[model samples]
Target: MSGLSAALLELRRTLDQEMFPLKVGDTASDRHALKELAGQLDDYLLPRLAALDAPLLAVVGGSTGAGKSTLVNSLVGAEVTEAGVLRPTTLAPTLVVHPADAGWFSGTRVLPGLPRSTGGGRAEAGTLRLVTAETVPSGLALLDAPDIDSVVKANRDLAAQLLAAADLWLFCTTAARYADDVPWGFLRRARDRSTALAVILQRVPAEASGPVGRDLRRLLEENGLGPVPLFEIPELRLPENGALLPETAAGPVRRWLEELSADARTRAAVVHRTLAGSIDSLDARVRGLADSVERQRLGARELADLAESAYTAGLTAFDDGMRDGSLLRSEVLARWQDFVGTGDLMRGLESRVGRLRDRVVAAFTGRPLAERELTAAMANGVEALIGAVADGAAERTVDAWLATPAGRALLEDEDVAQAGRLGRASPRLQAGAERAVREWQGFVLDLVRREGASRRGAARAASFGVNGLGLLLMVGVFASTGGLSGLEIGIAGGTGVVGQKLLEAVFGDQAVRRLTGEARSDLAERVRVLLAQDRGRFTVLLSPTLEADPGRLRAVAGTIRAHRGELSGGGAK
Candidate 1:
């Protein structure tokens, strides 16, 4: 493929993958615009650019009951498309082309997304009916599109798609509904895209034609469509057979279309003009989509930051609980005191290091009941702290998300919120917290084993065993005197000092400090990891939106803009 085609193809791929899943600013409109741009690329720009020599497709589109099907039938002098009292007279769009031009419409060159049906009784949904008519000029084809204002959403969407695919739009509206907002909206779109257009004012009384036509023309001019052709078909009675309109009524439009078709240059001009306009319109439209992508990216970032902040605070809270002598209270304190006779240990902990060492050795060498209880108590305390921190983080993150529209939408999504998954901690978090604590305790035991590798250290460690030393290390971590105050100094602080001094006597003071610091750091690191897992629930929801790169979209738009001249010259052949 040529560079321009390759670039356009890349643009199409980008748009196809682009997402505005978040409920940010005007997201609904952004999604609609995205669909419209992608549809035009598939149904019109890419196909028409590939085959510019093909017949000019003039799609007849307008409000419901606007007589678009009747106008098309009258112009072709046959009922190739259905017309009736039904609200949506045309269910499936009908494309009328001369027998010589049947090959162009029969294939998948244009409107390829829609299925093609030749033997059309009534075309199925999303099917295009092809009808060959000798009355249609070879170089020009007319498509009778569904009502633009149909009550059926699919019909309205299909109408817009068909109109976007047209090289020329034959917008039909009755004189009475000429000023309606719906048709005017389409006319404005035609004006913006610079699509070649002609307005058919059907069902006009001769006397009212002048005033209505002038008013419609003025509205067109105000909407930047002043140069568009206007055809007025005066209201006239049809035959009993509900046949085509009188020749005089449809003659002007019929003659104009035929003359345009006979002149190859005119047909080419119409195709080229619409093609140029469509390509030129892409830069702004794509850039607008890029802006929406950026908004989604920013919104995702904001939610992620909120989650991160909540988890970070949770980590800080865990750290604070560890140091503030909080874990040293209640059951943990009672177990530690029971493991080492606290009454004597605390009273003389500061003065008698040697005696304390002997007492620690004797206590650890006995039956392992006290050691097991003390270790279990420490594990439970740590697990509880972690569980509380995770719960707080989950709650904070949920509350923060609920404050934002986009975040709330994601949290409320059925996939995210089913069974209330997003509003609280994961069901497995309690088990995860327990597992993490056990893992950290194992790490402390490993640290004790490694530290005891030296002959002298091993001799001292054997007196207490690795399990006893590991339990002492856990006590040192929780009962740190750094954040204690008041009565805590006498209770949790004194308890920690006993554990610290006992460790010092076993392994010199410096080693004891080093071991305590390592144990604390390891436990903190484990809690950090646990909190991060809890935070993942929120960030994962934002991942898809965050992955949409605005820069890629802008780059594609820039590439298209750089090739504007080439694109205007009818793209790469």
Candidate 2:
């Protein structure tokens, strides 16, 4: 493929992948614009550029009961398509081409997304009916599109798609409804895209034709559509068959189409005009879509940041609880005091360190009742702290997300909304916290065993057993008075002193300090992992938006803009 084709293809791929799932910044309109742009790429721009020599498709579209089908029939001089009193006369789009030009419309050359049908019966929804007519000009095909203002949403959507695919639009509107907003909307879009177009003012009395035509022409000029060809089909009775309008009524349009089609230069000029305009219009439309994608990306990042902040706060709270000696309370305090004989032994411990070492070593050899209780109490305290922090982070994230429209939409998603899962900690968080605490305890025990492996007190460590030493280390971590102030220091200070002295009895004062720092760091890392797992619940909801790369979209648009000459040259070929 050429560079321009490759760039356009990349643009299509980017648009296809962009979800705009987050309900951020006019998302509904952005999504609609995205769909329209993609549809035009598939149904018109790409295909037309690829086969510029193919017959021009002039889609006849307008408001409901505007006589679009009748115009197509009259122009072709045959009832190749159905026309009736039904609100939406055309259930499916019908394409009429000369027998020689049938090959162009028979396959997937244009409007490739819609299914093709050749059967005589009414075409089903989303199916295009192909009819061969000798009356149609050789280089032109007339497509009778469904009503642009049909009550059926599918019909209206199909109408817009068909019109976008046309090299020329023969927009038909009755004189009475010429000023309606719906038809003007399509006309304005045609003007913006520079699509070759003609307007037919149907059902106009001869006397009223001058005034109505002038008014419609003025409105067209006001909307930047002054250059469009305007045709007035004066009110006239239908033939006995009622299948087509009188020849005089459609003669001017018929003659114009034949003249345009018979002259290859005129036909190619129209094709090139619409093709060039469509390609040129892509720059702005694609850029707008890129902006929407960027919004989705940024909105998702904001939500992820909220989740990160909440969990970071959770980790900080966990650290505070660990350092302030908050975990060494009630049962844990009683057990520690009992295990170390705190009241008297904790006194004057700075000067009595050598004498108390023997008592600490002997106390660990037996694994007393107080030691087991203290171990259990310490594990329970760590687990509780983890669970509380995890829950707080989850609640905080949900509360923050609810304040934003896009975030609230994600939280409302069925997957995230089951029993308010996103609003609180995961049900399995308690178990996960418990598992993390157990793993940290094991890690501390390993650290103690490794630290004691090459020390003079190795025998004392073995006698105390790795488990007993590990218990004292855990106490040292929770009993740290580094973050305490006022009463907290006094309450947790004694506990810290007792733990320090006990560990020093087996592994000198320096080893005790190193061991405590290592164990505390290990526990904090484990808690971080646990909190991260909980945070995943919110971030996962944003995965679709986060995964879309906005830079790629902008790059594609830039590529197209830089290589416009290449695309124009290719289309001209």
Candidate 3:
């Protein structure tokens, strides 16, 4: 193969592999058009240009019952192609080549996607049948394609595929159907590609030919197709052989085709004109596809950003819930009050100090049942706050996703919207909070033991007992610095004062403050990890879209567009 042919093959492979996975319906470009263009490149343009000197192929295309097959047979002076009244008589395309040029059409020079078949057997489906007729001129081949507007979808697609392979289009339409939209749609396409073309107005009534021809000519000229030669095949009678009338009826059409076939330069010019125009259109078409790819990337990225924002809101809301003193009301407040009465703890701060210390020590050491009850209430309160924040985040994320095109696609699956619902508290959350609280309790006891080892307060620490002192510290941590303000602030602070006085008795005021700060920081760190785990649920929903990077796709398209001329066999201008 030549350098140009190899380049074209590589380009075809590249087009076959290119994909844009994101589909945003409202803002999405027509992907079907991109697919059709790629099909044409692989089935027609690339293969044809690879062997540029092959026989000029003219595809006979028209609306249903337009007599394209009859014309093909008449031009070749034989009944080589089938013609009938069935809605789509030409289910499979038939290619007629001069006996001398049979090798050219029989080989895979163009339309390589369709399997080649020899006679008419098994040609009812998508196959091309090759036929040879001695009378047809050697330099040209004619393919009778299915009706452009056939009711059968496969026929319509096959018609378009055959037309794309043509170096010239010999369009046939009747006087009655000539002005129809469907046939003109194809003529407009031929004009856009600068394909060499001629039209035959078959079954024309002699009386209406003059006026109808003039009107049709006017329409053609208006549409930039005035230069195309028009031939008239008057309504003629078919003989017993089912063959067309004598040579006189088709003489002019035949002579024109023969003249084209006899001139090698004219045939080459026709092939080159269509080939170059098709190749040059590649960059713009691919650029359109590339732009669609960018829209997909943008849409997917926006969805990921929305998920991140939703989770960030959850984290912020959870932080506010912890410090607002809202969780310390009702059951939690009742338990704390029962364990240490509110009146005496707040009033006897400086006065009656010995009585307050004894009462605080008795609350810690003597009432194991009250300590367990307060701990249970605090854990349940923290768990409930965490669950509410997670639910709010899930709802927010779903609402935002439903508003976007890409998000709508995701929401089509009911499970995706529900994926973020943290439902009941996970076992992991309950176990994690429990473990952190236990560790902090242990840390408080160690603090007392270390500090009491060298002080006069050592005897006081022994009476308070590590278990009681540790539970007291746990209550003080809940009445965190930020968690104390207003009336509730005074109440929670009063509780803190009881715990603080007890600890300060054993370890001095400065040591007690430092121990509280360290214990609070450790608990916060554990809670931070728990919140991060919850955020992962939303991220999981967006994983597939985020992983498919459109940048690589756009880069590939850009590379192909920039080098398309070199890739498409030098056909690019």
Candidate 4:
């Protein structure tokens, strides 16, 4: 069989068996698609089977008076099929199968929905009927059908069935009516599957033969029937020749039949080749759909990537903003200037701030910044802290520093602003930033004070006490030695206790203020610079530490770390 024939046969077989492997709904596209395929298969099979795919069927179809019965008689080499002047002689289908070849028609009932004929008669001759030809040899059959264009529906139906069954369709068209609409219409309908079509252009006129034959060939080619074998049987018109009916094999018609039957193998091969093309066409269409589906999948993947990137890119922007707004500027150096005061800047800053430690102890001595008050303050400070930390950010998102005391204080007090306008920074966020800043500043103050004392060559307290005590002691001695030696009395008279009182009254508060201010400022500046360098934003989150409850800031620092990480995508789900 040709590829097309094989494909159709296989497709029909599968349709007959595989209802639906996936059991998908009837509405599914695949299901609908398969149904369409089945419909196409049903339409294609008949013409294909009738074409020369198998030797069993060679449908002899033609119009009225085309000498169809005569051709059959010629093939049988007998008068078994009635011929001549018997217009519409085949009212009933006729079976002229050779005795041994009759078995192929026994299961005609399996054709499903088609009428069956047991042994037929002449009235039933060309009726819608099927019968195997006795001379079919092996792998061969012939169906002599009624006129397709006849007024009789039975004749048309009979012609249709015969067309459906024939393995080779010998489309017998007389030269006078080859262009008739009805017969060619049937041929076109089955063209997809049918193969090796033989168009017998019979009974042509002598004078008009050339133009007529050329027109027929052109018509056939235009209708996709170009390669169909063509045979010419010029008009006998024996009556016009003043002769009786012609004898067997005595005309061009017989020679055409002989030519067709001469090489059965080549005809079958041609039929199979035609069928193959059909299968290839279907495969190409299916693969085109597959490629289109693949393109859709690629588009989906690209969309997924874009969504993830857009969402994740926020963290990167936030980090860049925080880095820019950080408190590491020169102003930080000024706040911490005293820390580097009298020597190498950073070292001197450390030393001068240390001396301010004692004044720090005295300043907060009587009234400490209460824990409860400081806690509340810290809550506010933490808010201020992170708020300040994130201050000046372009796309600032961090809410509060969460270091309550420092955040609260910083918010109420810091020069800059930031993160939490949400409310206040939580005191918990600082963890330990408050006390850290204070102790840090206190240590520097102590160092500064010690350095100042050393510079003065003695402790200020010791000098004051020594001078006062010595003056009192001298006065007591002078008075007690009222009648003592003249030298001691003269020394007391020259310097006297009054001079010491004048000196003490003149220098007291000023000297202390001047010295303490230097120490305090020195320590404050140093602490500021250190905080900026080591943990500027951090210190902001733990502010007011030097004055009040520093513990709250200690709590908030941890929250800052956790939230920043989670927000940054560093933390796990």
Alpha-carbon local distance difference test for all models: 0.84, 0.83, 0.72, 0.43
TM-score attained by model 2: 0.91
Candidate 3, position 431, lDDT: 65
Over 1-573, each residue of candidate 2 has an lDDT whose tens digit, in order, gives: 667677787888887775688889999899899999999989987787777789978989899988888888888887788998868789989999999999987888788898999958788988999999888889999999999999999999999999999999999889789988988889988888889999998999888988998898899889999888888888877655337887778899999998999898899889988877887898888878877888899999998999999999999999999987778777676676577654564354454545555555566755478777877888898888888888899888988988999888877867566427666788888898888887888899899999889898898778778887888788788876666565446546755665677678778998888888888898899889889998987887788898888678778889987877864466333
In model 2, state the lDDT of residue 511: 83
For model 3, state the Cα shift of residue 141 in Å: 4.1
User: What tens-digit string does per-residue lDDT give for candidate 3 at 1-573?
Assistant: 544444445555655543444446533244565667777777667767667778889999999998888888888887778888777788889999988888876766678778888875437579889998888888899999999999999899889878878888999998889999998888898888778899988888989889888988998999999989998888877764337645777889889989888898888778888876676666566666655656666777787688668767876776676556666766787787666544444455545546655666667656777777877787677667666665666677778877876776666656554533433334465566666556655676676667677678877777776666676666666664465555566656656666778777778788877877776676566666675665566556556545544454455545555555553455432
- Ranked by TM-score, the better of candidates 1 and 2 is 1
- Show the colliding residue pairs in model 3: none
The lDDT leader among the candidates is 1
lDDT of 1: 0.84
At residue 89, give the lDDT of candidate 3: 85
Residue 216 lDDT in candidate 1: 88
2 or 4, greater by TM-score: 2
Model 3 residue 305 distance off true place after TM-score fit, in angstroms? 3.6
Error of 3 at 565 (Å): 6.4
Assess every candidate by TM-score. Answer: 0.92, 0.91, 0.70, 0.37
Candidate 2 stretches with Cα past 4 Å from truth are 239-242, 330-361, 368-377, 414-419, 480-495, 567-573
> Which of the two, 3 or 4, has more lDDT?
3
Give the alpha carbon lDDT tens digit for every residue of 356-387 in model 1: 55565677776478788888888898888888
